[model samples]
Target: MLHIEDLSYETGGRTLVDAVTLHAAPGETVGLVGPNGSGKTTLLRCVYGTLKPSAGQVRVDGTVLDGAKERARRIATVPQDGQSAFELTVREVVAMGRSPHKKFWEPDSAADRLLVDEALARVGVTDLAERPFPGLSGGERQRALVARALVQQPRLLVLDEPTNHLDIRYQLEILTLVRELGTTNLLALHDLNLAAYFCDRIHVLRTGAVVASGTPAEVLTPDLLAEVYGVRAEVAVHPATGAPTVTYLPGPRTPHATTAPASRPSAEQKTSAM
Candidate 1:
């Protein structure tokens, strides 16, 4: 449903994204996994039309994405940054998602309001509908933005760290909700464990390049983790769901062999010496 071909972006003589190519099939959730400053967000920005690519093209359903309105109608993005500029009711904020489906200054129809309410409810933010946006907590703001993205009803959904500031429960909830929507989803996630659990396929990015791409069981290995992230780790499957889990190993490594004590002192001898 979405295609990014040799997408590269650079500024000030430094490449933020370099020749990255990826796609999200219809009804599939593909994850972009990388550490901070690895060009995940910049690549996503190029895909979402926030920034133009220096040497490639972004296509939706076979046609190149060229403008804002058509792109909005086809792709919905929940950015990593969620700071609101103006004070607006939560409902109003979500209602803005409907603008693409309407003409200029055309009032929202009953269907739009219904979709907004349903989206808010789905994201578990219905009670905050009447509240002011700026007053919301960080997690609440993320949920609010997710609600807006849902209401947008685009064919492709792109999220840059959708779980930012969310608690563990909401982190799972937001990704699960996106999965249930069954749309073509491309999201940048920092948590490899979460990526393993939720994404059908994962793409690992290092610096500005794609280092690996495959299913969790295929891509996530101790060696790859060490190579890409410089972390000593072990990968195991969850007992319940069979998803991969990462266990990081910190501190210095244990010696392969250790010397044994020459002789053990008896408790009575130690007591007498003391």
Candidate 2:
């Protein structure tokens, strides 16, 4: 389980995440949906320990997580724009996920290698395992990163824009893989339709605050999209999957950018777990 209590982030006198509180239960998939600069990335960075929150705490299984090594053991993150700066091979990159479990100088065990190989295959990046990290296409790199996160065996998985660089097919496949992992998942997604279909609950953020949160059917109305995104859109329930589906309408852009009041955190605010 993952719990973020009254989380807030500030930099240069600007608040990016403002008093956000949310939780994911043992095996739920929770999504953050918002326009650009709405603090989705900032919030995720705080959760993964990349950027410390100016206030509030991040907890796993009811205990606050502290220290990079300890956080790595429990939370695995596939960042929004994950790219390797080093000239490592794909296998080496994925193998790094095992570092939290090993001593400083320990070599990869056979079991560790097996896990890496399996994760690579699962993400369909086995063919690129020998390739240099910087040489792969964006989609390939994204798959490799997911493979790395999988090998970590984390209790919580935080993904920001997990489908950003993928085509339609791989997008579905990757999200399906995430769901099947059955871990607590906290993801920030730009694609509302994808969020509606895959996420068990969705939190709508605007201007660094959660304006609304609920199951897709309850929160993804045309009015909400118009207010938060400044665009006209049509939302409906999908007959097959019973999920809310969004069909954006082409219209003159509106300046209706006022955000709704932030949703009050409740005891039952649902969050996904891994």
The numbered model that scores best in lDDT is 2
lDDT of each: 0.85, 0.86
Lowest-sum lDDT 10-residue window in model 1: 255-264
54-88 per-residue lDDT for model 1 (tens digits): 99899999999767999999999999867777989
In model 1, the runs with Cα more than 4 Å from the true position are 252-274
lDDT value for candidate 1? 0.85
Off by over 4 Å in 2: 252-274
Model 2 — TM-score against the truth?
0.92
Best by TM-score: 2
Q: Cα deviation in Å at residue 20, candidate 1?
A: 0.6
